[model samples]
Target: MTNSRQKIKKKQQDVVRFLEANKIEFEEVDITMSEEQRQWMYKNVPPEKKPTQGNPLPPQIFNGDRYCGDYDSFFESKESNTVFSFLGLKPRLASKAEP
Candidate 1:
């Protein structure tokens, strides 16, 4: 089985191809990094194993802050509620519930 990074890379490639075929204008960002480099950057990185059910998505860095999202937006946004829903989690409520 391919790692999450590898899987995302493949999907990116597919998107690029689809865009090119349709004459869409876009820029492709290559965020691929070596395993050693990733380890040096992040401590306690998990091994590249097959993803399991309910496995939390990876961490993301945005505007100098670290956040976690679902596999879809994990590498993109830190403010997306879709990520929370994807992980079977609910957004926190601001007001307390009344009994």
Candidate 2:
């Protein structure tokens, strides 16, 4: 594999590992294998969310149809409930309440 491909693959793996550690389920889409998805992501996701020069490539995270930024943004959200809130989820499973 080319150097670029290896780098991208590693980034993807890092993000996936983060999700798993946080108990967040996600779907992985290898854009190189799907041009339709690539076009859709670039079109649907706002330009501001696009990667600037020298930043990481794809492997972006989305909440349903909404863009949730990249891996750095995910970790940055540690100070707030944005991550769980964006995913429409609670940080961790809560105990059952008494009737």
Candidate No. with top lDDT: 2
Backbone clashes, each candidate: 0, 0
What would the TM-scores of all predictions be?
0.32, 0.69
Query: lDDT by residue for model 1 over 2-85, one digit each (tens)?
Result: 897777666566545644664545544333445653443243323342155533223322222222222345333224534334
| TM-score of decoy 1 | 0.32
lDDT of 1 at 73: 51
Candidate 2 lDDT over 24-98, as tens digits, reads 878988777898988777776667776675433676778778887766676566447567865566667676988
Candidate number with greatest TM-score: 2
